[model samples]
Target: MAQRGFWIPLSLILVFASFVSLWWPGPNYGTDFRGGTEVEVVFTKAVEAHTVRQTVESLGYQTPDVVQVQDVKSPSHFIIRVQEVSSVTDATKEQLKKALCLTTDAAAAVADEHACPSNARATEVTFSPGGDKISTRYDSTPDLEKIKEQVRSVGGINLRAAADNPQIVNQRDNHVEIQLQSKGDQLMDGLRDKLGADTVPAQPLKVEWVGPKAGKQLRDSARNSVAIAIVFIMLYLAFRFDLRFAPGVVVASVHDAMVIIGVFVVLRKEITVSTIAAVLTIVGYSMNDTVVIYDRIRENLSKHRGKSFWDIINMSVSETLSRTILTAGVTMLSMLAFFVWGTGVIRDFALAVVIGIVAGTYSSIYVAAPLTEWIDKRMTQRLGAKKKRPSGKRRAKAVTGKPAEAK
Candidate 1:
């Protein structure tokens, strides 16, 4: 017989580890679940993640979760995640105005000052009104192209020349308008200040915000879905097999889920909708594995009637071992590829699958089979005790020393 002495201890340890991991820091929920903003920024030139983090942090905001958006066509892209803000604050607007305003000599042409900010070369420094729309004025005809390029560095989008133009002698003729989108644009000015005016402009490719209520709804839905799935699995197993087999299958499935979730908790990976989907998928996968082994055990029961229950189980597992390995191996390889090369949610989903697959395989072999065998043994013992009990008529016949009539 295979020695299972270590199985109980190992299972206990794993359960304890999972408990601790979940109780301490807990699983790290992503923007999808926790309610936050996700911004995808595409720069004209490649920027390092550390530099981005440093720049974002310097702007009086928490460091965002940053990941490089890897693609052959768009190599200079990054995705940053932070808490959501409803609108830009007045203080942030003022900072942006100061950063965009350039102090240049009255005689300096707009084209000459476009390359870099000349603090020492400037004869006068002026700023537009600090409001939703900011406009800058200059004595000479400002290079609209250069001004637009500069505005872009500070998250200024939809740039246009203001309607007001002065052709009067010794008066400013250039006026430019800037429109700001979100609070994130406030960082643009800070970034320009740090990276210099010559740096390539950063453009917002996508922005996603999840409200707290919406996040709560999503979390509740994810929980309900998982619970419903487990219930359905238990019902299906009980209907398909003997009641004795259902407990083991359900326990194994739950064990697989907990272990997979525990891994994410330990790793501090974000739990997104994709993660929930992966977990549910793993439940089905694990149930399938357990069912296959259970089917084999059932088939062997009549064929190996004289064999001990333990022997039968062992033989069944041995017979199906190759199939189990092949199936899990192929699936694991595919998930591994996704984990290694995939990006964003796809990568996280693959990671969850990888963990679930290992846990499921282990539970199927060690957890489900042993549990079924134990339950079957307890049931047999109970039935045997009942059968060994003498009936009331039998007891009376023995006391009276007379044989009972045959039924």
Candidate 2:
């Protein structure tokens, strides 16, 4: 209790390290918030990450990250990330117009002149609100099959029309909407085309993409949610105990959060949607640990009213230390299984929780307890100073919050 100042330096060092590590190279955001494409695939045979990286990079994609998934069923499973793919670019749309003889380049370029004819092409090609559904409007219906084939070949085979086939909104006006499957098809096609010898892109694959606007919204919402949570927790603590205890809990929670985040930043792990979930979960978990300590201290304060404030904090923390360790250890061990076999996102969540448990335990003692003690010390000094002040008309007026009628 007397040597609390010595321990404060350690906490400062940790915060400094975490802050520097977090902001230096910055965080690498995942597809959920970074507006990118992610593809998960399984290779037929065991392959190294670098080998797969080369294969994917050869498909005109520059330096796409390839990571091997730790799945028991498929040892060769891998995930790939591409910043953007299957974009409905203006160039692709223009070529679609040309191939349909809507432009001058159509007649020579397209093979079936009779079936396609002239003056027969889509008037407009527009993407849906979500940008996955593509609608093409034409003055008259051209050949659907040829249009599908030409659209597939254009813009480096990026856009894929789903097998569900194009749905015609208007037969007379030739308004058709095509569902966009994924850039994965093109990715798989490229992989199979390039790696037919290797036979990768093996069985089932999954892909997901988030638009930039949508991703930003998610990121902003996640921050707001975390902040709102902390505010509520602070209010709960204040009402539950007092201002002395509430600040410590809030500070400890924030410290745990920053340190855990610093950990991911140091590891260069992407802060995915799952990671955010883990963070929120950790806040509640850490708060629970702090509350346990605070509860114990509050109980002891009543039992030992004569004891000094620091002595009470020290005794309370010492009494609860073993319980904290045992509880945190069990929780971490449970998460260990998830770390061992869970997929990427699950593993991320598990890893975060594990780190947070350790951090929460430490902060509850060193950071939270000490902060409360310091606040108590300051408050006591103010009280003692007020007691020494001259008890005259000025003090009387100040104390009563009204003027003294006579002195």
Candidate 3:
């Protein structure tokens, strides 16, 4: 009881951490989450973090939201995200390439490959036949020559070319669109091919948008899955042994989980999809460890005819100590490998597992088993069912108020 009391303060600290994270959300990268653009860049050379930002700024772009994505599967690659690149032109793309390319050979080779900007240019050229201005909207960035020829081909009896000057209103690194003198569908189609093969309406881009919706949904789902798993684990323990046997296992599993969550919150690690998956995985993992110790308690209760409950629990935990240590030790080594070498996305997850494995091992032996014994003893005392001493009926035969006969 005295030893268990020592954990109370630590447990309270972990609880407070969980509460803080619940109310005060932490930082999440990307303009999508915070309403900005996210530019992802892959690089081949080992580079400094600040240099990447400088490169982005040199290309007439703002300082990017940079993060090092370390992939254990492929350790050499890097992923850098730059937000707010809504308009990319060929010149801008060239500038970006020039800024990011580190190797002299790589930079020099791709330096000369500049294509005329393929973004669309649109302008109102003339009034429609009904005096309503007919606006020409192309689906793609049209070739300047093709656009001029198409304009001349449209002869001006009903449709007259009003403006021949092409201007880029919106630009992006990969795609652009131009306004035209006519609103006719045929003209829009003719302009589509010249806009290059990659242009699409902004609607498709919206479909590609990664923002609050996805992140929130992912966060909520991860939270719910952990909760449901714990509830079911408690229910199973209650059914198998007794509700009295459940609190210990549930508390221990929760302790492991809270520590993991608290560390992540403090460190400000991004809770990616992989991290969520890891949280769910650890729930099952830590619960399994607690259940093993609980199962031993059950076995000892049925097999040991007269041992006290606390004694039985203590013995069970002691007996399982070697197994728990061995399993957790091996697992910790593997998780350590993942943490050291894993990509940024999954690194936090691996660290969480490392924390969870240690916590789970402790709880199974110290928290869960001891708490089980504590609760069982208190319940027995309350019910007036303390283990009884043997009656003196047999002693009377030996005494007989005199010397007893030898067997």
Candidate 4:
């Protein structure tokens, strides 16, 4: 038989790494959920997140936040958020696109500087408010025709082009600001066709950006959430099984979470606020699978005391293999739909769920159940050999031997 103890050390290592990242994650969320520039656009028709993401990508930005933020009182809503980075020049183009798409009073808040002072060294182009005497930022001028083509496709108009001179702020930290023309709000209303129908409009003039305040809150909340979740799962497992089984399940859950987070870090996927929510959701999902497998293990142990530890564990996993596979398949199908059809905001959320489900399934069979059996065997050997307690009235039956009552 394979040595069951071998998996415990690996489980512990994975859990420790994941717990560290919960507090010290490197990526930051977008302003929409985290509070940055609120660019609200009302399209000529309904739009989808993928199209918006594509348009933004074409404009030379990374994926922006596209969420349905609504005012409880008003039927009207809008999609809000910032730009992504492609090439260096695209960043400036992104800012300009954001300025033109504005449909909120917040757009007017952008500075009219020729180019942002802080970004001067990095950005190849400059930004200025749309008009004459606009200060130029970059040495090389961008193709205005290309810019106009993409802008028009995404429902952008009002052509008064200038250099990509980005206005700089003295915030002493990293951030971008955008200002819309007086027609900004109306302009956004015209571009609503780019935002998908599933998106609900948000209140106008709301500022969205990732600042220190939102960042810290996001960090703390993610940390606290993970801690609380792990604690609760451990408690629940302990209550249902013995304390010995709890450690194994917790290890497996943490392993699943860690592998997902590590992959995200390596992939450099934007870890947004929604990403944290996704992590928490995945944790619960992973625990659910672990619990189901564990339940089977306890049942098998009761039914077959004469079986070897490896046999019992293998049996439990095999018995539930069909259920686990079906459940995982159905859950993944739903997540796949969200991922393929959903917008940028929740795409990460769905991706995280998919990763967690796969990892959870593997850990339940290979990690949790196996580890539980290993520990149980170790405990039984130690106690059964060490103590000479009789098969008497008081002691309950060990998994390996007959219970006192039965004897």
TM-score of each: 0.70, 0.83, 0.58, 0.53
Kindly report which residue stretches of model 3 are placed more than 4 angstroms away from their true locations once superposed. 21-40, 44-47, 54-64, 69-78, 82-209, 385-407
Count of steric clashes across candidates, in order: 1, 0, 25, 35
RMSD of 2: 5.2
The number of residue pairs in model 4 that clash at the backbone is 35
lDDT (10s digit) by residue, model 1, range 1-407 = 37666885687688778878877888788778887677777677668889888887876667578878666677867887777553444555554544455444344444455454442122333332223344465545555444555556554343323443211223344444444445555555566688665563654777677766788899999989988898888898889988989988888877887887788888888888898999899999999999999999999998989998899889998999999999999999999999889877888899999999998888888988998889999999999999987777786687787767667
Q: List the residue pairs that clash in candidate 2.
A: none
After the best TM-score superposition of candidate 4, give how far the Cα of residue 16 lies from its true spot, in angstroms.
7.3
TM for candidate 1 is 0.70
Model 3 lDDT, residue 191, Cα: 23
| Model 1 stretches with alpha carbons more than 4 Å out | 45-50, 68-77, 88-180, 183-202, 390-407
Q: Which stretches of candidate 2 lie over 4 Å from their true place?
A: 91-125, 129-132, 136-143, 146-163, 168-175, 202-204, 391-407
TM-score of 2: 0.83
Best by lDDT: 2
Instruction: Please name the candidate that would achieve the greatest TM-score relative to the true structure.
Output: 2
lDDT of 3: 0.56
Instruction: Write candidate 2's Cα lDDT for 191-270 as tens digits.
Output: 87876747664444787777777789988998888888888999999999999889898888888888788889988888
Name the better of 2 and 4 by lDDT. 2
